[model samples]
Target: MERDFKMTAITMAGLEEVLADELRKLGAQNVKEGIRNVSFKGDKGFMYKANIALRTAIRVLKPIKTSKVFDEEDLYEAIQRIKWERYLDVEGTFAIGAVVNSKNFTTNSHYISLKSKDAIADYFMHKYKKRPNVDLKYPDVKIHIHIHKEWLTISLDSSGDSLHKRGYRSATNIAPINEVLAAGLVMLSGYKGDENFIDPMCGSGTILIEAAMIANNIPANINRKHFAFENWKDYDEDLYFVIQDALLKKITSSHFKIMGFDKAPSAIKKAQQNIINANLEEFIGVHHVNFFNSKKEVFGKTTILFNPPYGERLNINVEEFYRKIGDTLKHNYENSTAWLITSDIQALKYVGLRTSKRVPLKNADLDCRFVKYELYEGSKKMKKQIDIGE
Candidate 1:
């Protein structure tokens, strides 16, 4: 059995707690939350499970070494000291990425990456006659450099591409929510496979797809093109397949419906294509209709989660659009819990509904809030809408 070691699961800024809970549930030991990450310890099989099953994790990194650095030489020497041969061969290709949050670094991420790359190549060249070539796009090894103040940590990225590229989305919108964020929202909204899921402003059906995947307990990265760990020298292909097979056995179908709506023909078409790509056609349906003009498709309780246009990307009047959203929820969607993630705080006031909960989150570079509103069954507005009876 491989020895257990600490690993960090990178996540969206506000989802640290949720991701930590996920790690705990996945059987990680000594789980701890950081700003936009969580740390835990597990063996190789568990690491494979994490990359495959962690819905909120953007990437999982196995820390190989940690050292204090006051300057660039310290960074280079610490990196060179790690036995890179243990993870990658001299002829193999590799890529480096940096996430530096330190004053001592005093350089752009690209510069850090280049320095790390050079250190690795030089280390290999001194030992072996030839050195590994840098393949930025697709590499046999992916290294992550994290610098915090004077501390430098080098890690091996277990998940190659961002896990958000779940190998299912062939189409996207102008500002589609990141899949990791989408999944985190669904998880945070308290949706299990038990309730009906709806996305009114479903741009390309990301929320809907993530909801269905969660509902079915589907492994988050089951459709990923590849995981970087698969290329490691110690990679156990059979062990990985065993983990994948185990995850497959856990999938269970949900009885409730999952649906999406978008007024744009382009969005509707792309959503359908993406939903098909996810193999969730039976559980999800996309329709072409303006959200404000539509009512809840389900009769009983429903959970609606979506990312409406934040107005930064489009020319629409954000305030009025938000008002319509509030009106639609009040009149149309009774007995429902509606949540939306948006960067527009001022526009949120225009919605007019009292937010039951507000979660501060960062979407890409934008500071956003995930707000929730409860629609009571048989409220005055619902009664009025039912009286008018559309």
Candidate 2:
């Protein structure tokens, strides 16, 4: 059995707890949540499972070294001191991604990455008289350099190309939500394939696809072609397949309806194509209908989630658009719950519905709110009476 080691899963803001829960459910040890990440201990097989199954994780990083550095020279020296020959070969290629937030260094992340790269190259040149090449697009070794205040952590990027690139989205709209974010939102809403799922303003069908996957208990990255760990010298191909097969066997079919809607014919077409790419055409349906004019089409309890335009990427009347959203939900939709994320705070007030829950989240670079509203079959008082009678 491989020895357990510490690993960190990075996620967006407001999703640390969600990611931590995911790690714990996967049988991680000493799970802990941080600001935008979760740390835990797991073996090599567990690491592979995490990369393949975590829906809310952006990337999984394995920290190899930690030190306190005061300047760029210290950073470079500290990186060079590590035995690079263990992780990369003299003839192979490598890449460095850095994030610096320190008062001691006035330089930016780009310069820090360059300095780290030079240090690694020089280390190889000194030992073997030749250095490895740097390939940004595809590299044998991908390193992550994080500097906060005086603390520095050097880690290996195990999940390559970010877990958000689930390899199923070949077609995308102008402002498609990140796959991780979409999955996170669906998980946060507490939908587990038992209830009908709908994305009223579904763009490219991301939320719809993620919802269907969750309902079916499908592994998040089952469709992904490769991971950075596959390039590692210690990678166990047989063990990876074993873990993958276990996850595949856990998948269960969901009968509840999962649907998406868009006013644009082009968006509906792209969404259908992407759904087919995911091999989920039988589970999800995309329709070309304006959300403002549509009503609840499925029976029983329904969960409606969407990433509406916030007047950030698309041109629209922000206040009136939000008002119409509230209006449609209040008058048309019944026996359902709705959740929408928007960066427009002032416009949210125009929705005119009392929110049951509000969460702060970040979409791309914009600060946003994920608000939930419950639409009853009749009045709240009448619904309460019905519940009391039951």
Candidate 3:
């Protein structure tokens, strides 16, 4: 019945291979990628590290059981078999989140979760005569059921909340990107410790913070307040401290520049506050300046990664803003690899530059394209007619 004898499953957001790779670097063994989650084998200490350090993982789950269920009846039986007393007491509250992707279970995820909840409640009612209450917001025990075809994998949500909540940002402007997605974008850009990084529209300084951590080889979750491992019944304090110390020892000094720019003074202030909150003020700088008016930095091999306003939620004129972005990148920034993520496919074409690479990425419900443009100082790479009509 020892916790170390059981296997753990770490769940992550989908299409975030770079984030999965980051998990592997942190000493997670048997790291495997699925649709929107990664399954890795680790002990309690590694679980703590995964919750604290994984940038792209939404939550880490310690899977309790996997079974073949043909119907809801079979699902109930599978749930009833597990010894839930180890994870939750009769006084504690619990919640079930079901993610179904099978032909037999064609209903919505909510309905599947309802059935699983009923099974757990019935089991506790029969055994203890008083079942645990269901607390959706803050549950003592959160269960995850991922049904793929006939296989149903039940896991305990080790991370109560998503790992993206690093507890740094106190404010957010319109259309702020998720911290995990921002970190993934930083990783995908391949900007290591060698180059200067800039986020012109760095709302809340998420990209700049993530970039600084990546450049300095710092643990992503060092600023976070809590991890699921802290709540575990068999938590090992000494082992967790050792892992933390080892990761801290690997931190290298970052010599590269990480700069942020925002036209709004309010955004700049918020970004600076968040940067300071993360204890990265010494490594990062924030300034209030319109990106269109700003030129490339003095460093020739600079990398600019940003999430510009898409005018989807904001009330900006899309055509003019897109034109200005293209104008700024083409005229001011040269000999740099500039990348921006935008969900508007139409607006991306208006950039007026040949895209070196067009990567498919998702921003919540919006399917976005992460496009890159290589700007050269001379006319050698500039075509007579730089077409982006396609």
RMSD in angstroms, all models? 3.6, 1.1, 4.1
lDDT tens digits by residue: candidate 3, 1-390? 324423343433445577568767877777777667666777777777777677777788888899999888888899999988888888888888888888887688999899999988888899999898999987877888988899999988888777788888777787778888888888888988688998988888999998998899887888777665565666788888898888888888778789999989999988988888888999999999899899986675889999987746647888888888889988998878899999888997778888888888888888888889988876533533344332
Ranking by lDDT: 2, 1, 3
Backbone clashes for every candidate come to: 0, 0, 0
Candidate 3 regions off by >4 Å?
1-14, 382-390
For each candidate, the alpha-carbon lDDT, in order, equals 0.91, 0.94, 0.81
Best by lDDT: 2
How high is the lDDT of residue 30 in model 2? 91
lDDT of 1 by residue, 177-278 (tens): 899999999999999978888999898888999999999999888888789998998899999999999999999999898889999999999999988888
TM-score of every candidate relative to the true structure: 0.95, 0.98, 0.91
Poorest 10 consecutive residues by lDDT, candidate 1: 378-387
Task: Choose 1 or 3, whichever is better by lDDT.
Answer: 1
Top TM-score model: 2
Selected candidate, larger TM-score, 1 vs 3: 1
Tell me which of candidates 1 and 2 scores higher on TM-score. Answer: 2
Candidate 1: C-alpha RMSD to true structure equals 3.6
